[model samples]
Target: HPKFDMVMHDLLVLLKPKFVVMDATFAMEGNGPNRGIVIPMNLILASSDLIAMDKLCCEIMGIDWTDINYLNFVDQHYQREEAEPQIIGEKIEDVTQKFLLPYDDLAVRAQRWVYKNYFLTRLCFGTPFLNMLQGCLNVYRKVDEEIMGKEWVNKYWDNSLPR
Candidate 1:
């Protein structure tokens, strides 16, 4: 549990990716991946440095980058001698949009607790009936996609970003 963050950070470092291209256009906040409030942040971000890019993205998103685990892990492990990235387009102040964070609601908190708790995990997860949860989530995703993502999909097809 303790070294999990370090392990993940190490794995990313090991890959040594050349560049990062982030699509912040139609970013999601709150509970994400089909079910969330979508922010129409019409900007594409790119950087040769992943960590610097992430830090800049976090600033643009109006959140503290230090709060993120992998970023924090890197900060803790590596020296802070690296210089910040230079912005070529919109200033962070002009584009900053504060997004509502996910997993803060009671339901999510309870779900996280249940999944993390040993006894609850053994009782709840070690069952064939638990497969229904996936099915239910899939159904929810489809419904959400139809309701919310449909508009975005249509807009994307038409190349029309909502202003």
Candidate 2:
């Protein structure tokens, strides 16, 4: 996740998507998908400019874009010069909701572990250990889904949104 902004920056640089559409009808807060609360947002935003769209969405989620370093990098990469896009529809303030960002305790702890150095991370990815790790992740995700995900969807995700 630490490198996600960089990863996204590179991906956007290469693909240069013509448009990005976000479904804000029901979004996750707190620990995100692994373990997060659901909130109803009830809106869809689209744009040809990914950076602009992302910035607006960030604000809607009550997060400061400046705090996200990679976003700044990408903004600079696109030569945005920190100029915000003009929102086309509803006022951002009307729809804004303060989101609880992820803590990712497990990831943080794993990153701090002595054995999880860069070399070992790269090595693990290319070895059978990766499969074992993925298997464990699948089990963890499934348990979380069973314990929380399904119920959240049923309760917060409304039928009004696109299927």
Candidate 3:
């Protein structure tokens, strides 16, 4: 939660974008922002308000906006009473589709638990630990590719994308 909050809120304060737009035509589900199943929704979302945009995205995905940790933090920090955002295009209710979330049931609970716990957050995000954690993940990815084959490695990884 610390890392997510840092990136979502704190970093935004330092480096705010002029606008935010998301391609929701095919949204990812299950352990997202990484490996996940894609669902076709045929919609595009855009807003100057990042928080509002994100909340609407979650709603369109048929998930509770509050279920996301960073969103909850933003909601509280901003003192938001309602989750409604001004709709400029398609109505969210008309396009809502339930997406299968990431991780097993136990893993989901464990993830939430870790995010909510201060001790766990410190252990995961403190000082040089985050860098070390990233390094470990990199090593794991290399090992996974070698063992499982490089089917997921993109042609663009080395700037060899087909024109």
* Best of the candidates, lDDT: 2
- Candidate 3: give the clashing pairs: 30-102, 31-102
lDDT score, candidate 3: 0.75
TM-score of each: 0.66, 0.70, 0.59
Clashes of 1: 0
Rank order (by lDDT, best first): 2, 1, 3
lDDT of each: 0.79, 0.81, 0.75
By summed lDDT, the worst window of 10 consecutive residues in model 3 runs over 76-85
Tens-digit lDDT string for candidate 2 (1-163): 5477689888987897887898888999987676889999999998878888877888999999988777888877654334557677799899999998878497767765625577776667657888998999999999999999999989988869887
Per-residue CA lDDT of model 3 for 84-131, tens digit only, reads 557976776899888888776676687678778888866866667879
lDDT of 1 by residue, 139-160 (tens): 9999999999999888776666
Instruction: Quickly count the clashes in candidate 3.
Output: 2
**Cα-based lDDT at residue 112, candidate 3:** 74
Which stretches of model 2 miss by more than 4 angstroms?
Answer: 80-84, 112-116, 133-163
Please report the candidate that would top TM-score against the real structure: 2
Task: For model 1, state the Cα shift of residue 70 in Å.
Answer: 3.1
Two-way lDDT contest, 1 vs 2, winner: 2
